[model samples]
Target: MAEEMKRMIALGFEGSANKIGVGVVTLDGTILSNPRHTYITPPGQGFLPRETAQHHLQHVLPLVKEALKTARVTPDDLDCLCYTKGPGMGAPLQVAAIVVRVLSQLWKKPIVAVNHCVAHIEMGRIVTGAIDPVVLYVSGGNTQVIAYSEGKYRIFGETIDIAVGNCLDRFARVLTLSNDPSPGYNIEQVAKKGEKFIDLPYVVKGMDVSFSGILSFIEATAEEKLKNNECTPADLCYSLQETLFAMLVEITERAMAHCDKRDVLIVGGVGCNEQLQEMMRIMCSERGGNLYATDDRYCIDNGAMIAYTGLLAFAHGTTTPLEESIFTQRFRTDEVHAIWREKEATEKKAN
Candidate 1:
């Protein structure tokens, strides 16, 4: 009764990339508020870490005020403060870390250093109610096939070079596509008008996928092909999306089979694509499994994911000391021991 009655709330800040977000969440899976602003670059350009950090510096405080107002919670109401610790741009990642540190000092609250990738997985799990599903985490910075094993989110497969979303973003830049909302989002929209299926490159080395080769080929030939009317921009977008999504699906399926898991959970920024979701759904259905997914609100980088995941850690008696709450740019998802998870698969069975 006491456990059920206890309510722990966390205020989280996320500025690991172009987006700066603030969110408030409770241990009971209640999201009081999740507000964010993205630092959108002009068409055909990507956001640099330094400029992105400057943007975050300009907007973090306002977003925090907005989040608190939206949640109707004061600093005293929060049980803990949370912020993403790593696996993101160094400059942008530090903005959130510093903000959380200041807040921790002011409010006298404990801090929880969250792994960004794990936050995405935990957010997907809570939103979709997926239990023990193989995770396909696709984003601008990461691409991985993950599963739970022995108290950890194990990486079964991953990208060898550029991420899947990075491929799409660069392709969009090559075509001079708009980045108003996002390059990947625009690519998905343009791909809908694509009729021809232009083959580029298919690279799958074991469970790892490589997008750099495919992207480089596209970059070299997209202009020439478009100039010669060999393939429309839509066709190129379509073909690129198809190849990337297919590679992801392939690795995810292999992980599922290897893990003997029947459910698949898609997470991260690129996971918001409906076409990718449908393809994964079909694959899951064919294998008599389930596909768990969330929309853009949860899939994209946001503070609620950090808050909720942090609350989970806090509830598990996990806290980050002030001196140890520093950020990094290369924290792997598999490095976090998911102490909140009660049950884990002991080992992978032989295939």
Candidate 2:
């Protein structure tokens, strides 16, 4: 009874890729502190696993301490520890799991393993107050259109090859753009000046999308076109964004229609783009639906989402054993059994 009366808190660690984030969250979805550091490579380059893992190790502990300090909570105040378990870079995922394992042993708190995709959706729902929304998750490593069904956030559609963010990042590199904040962000900023839209390859097969062909085509011809003054960087950026976001909106709307849902939730880092959000909003509005999104804080990979999802799972009797606390790089979103949403799914289906 006394333990039940106490406010349950979770300390979460997310080092699934270039970003290393630590956050303190309560069971009621209140975020006390979320601090993170991103490992940015030089322009025209992408971060590799070894370097990214080292970066996570260098900053994770300090960030954890800072999160605790800012949240005004100690290890004793936390009820559990959580971390991103899969669907990320292997070495980077291991960094968070290793840290959480040590913390669990020291603090004598239970551990909860969270799926990264599920965390994104859960965080968007909590922040935007969106319920039963068809989600479009676009990030550096993943791109998927998802909806809840049969107690899982099922993937209705996804990228067949490289993700949309990767395509945008590669295009930014071709333009020799800065990666200070993000490649996608730089592309968005430059795209604002674009007037004429040069036609690019638009590939959409059913509910899935493919960007490798477009990226290869752009990589081969962008510089030549720029040198010949055939197309400006802004025009290229604008065309690429329009083509890709249209494919995304198409598939997301398809999923929404298939699920009979009226709300759209955009998650992951690439969802932070205003252009993408606007396109999705227009599509949702045409369908008499609402579009939901968040800023960089919750949209990018962060520990707050992991903490909140793990807290929800923990409250619903989910726990991770020490031996089973392992990292998987290819875990799919549908692989997770969302015990917390079982009742909701059943009721929704019944209705």
Candidate 3:
């Protein structure tokens, strides 16, 4: 029977946080279609969780429709549906969860709730083909250093409070920088034009990291310096980038040392930073190790990675029963059982 051709199609929903990204991916790791919908919280919105959820609800359907059209696939063609399980806004996740559940029911297929962080890691692997690399996820709400251990994905280190991207966004907001597209983009532009590095605290707790303190220190310094005419925005931008990227790279290097792994894979929105990528590449090269990253297609929020990971999960026969499945606000990466390899092995044996 040739093991039923080992075929599968997955539709991924990523309404976690602010990005309403959707895509269709195939079992061969090919991204058939991807569409992204981005929303920026107004400055005075105060990080209201409910507001973020509403934002996601408004954009999910349109993004999904575009993705399906781009992939030239219909809902009926999807073998399963996948969504970010947790570590995101309750309402936003619910929006995606509800959509996935309804779609699964309509298509008479299963749903696979995936960990957002794990999806990032798996995407790195798929794009870069880096086996067992130390993975770093730096995004709006997360900063984690992960390595696969035993039967679980182990978090060797992570943010004690705020994530790296959050720090940059908050700082950009304080300066009243543009948020039309993204605050990160403005910060990166400023950092490039800047010539000096304003001093900022580097907080590293063993393997764990804390960016809140650094963010606060930078804000205070900026205010005091502006009053005393001590620093400029360009200089401040340069300094902030240096400090933040250094802290991230340092911990990643330490993780590599601790794990004795040479391969490093970085994912998430912040992973798009060229400076950070350069730093990691230098560190990896210095250690005679390899480093991998994705282009904007996979780095910035997109559904392709989710769809890819979902395809692997579905192919391995790991699925969530529609009735019992629900969106999770605190899904952990290690909770996902690794089934990709096993499923492939079984298929080969059967053949």
Query: Which runs of model 2 end up more than 4 angstroms from their true locations?
Result: 1-6, 345-351
When 2 and 3 are scored with lDDT, the better candidate is 2
RMSD in angstroms between candidate 2 and the native structure over all alpha carbons = 1.9
Task: Give the per-residue Cα lDDT of candidate 3 at 305.
Answer: 77
lDDT of 3: 0.82
Which residue pairs show backbone clashes in model 1? none
TM-score (C-alpha) between model 2 and the true structure: 0.96
What are the clashing pairs of model 2?
A: none
How many angstroms is residue 215 displaced in model 1 relative to the true structure, after the best TM-score fit? Answer: 0.3
- The worst-scoring run of ten residues by lDDT in candidate 1 lies at 342-351
State residue 9's C-alpha deviation in candidate 1, in Å: 0.4
Worst 10 residues of 3 by lDDT: 40-49
Give the residue spans of candidate 1 off by over 4 A: 1-6, 343-351
How much is the lDDT of residue 198 in candidate 3? 72
For each predicted model, how many residue pairs clash, with residues at least 3 apart or on different chains? 0, 0, 0
TM per prediction: 0.96, 0.96, 0.93
User: Model 2: how far is 107 from its true place, Å?
Assistant: 1.0
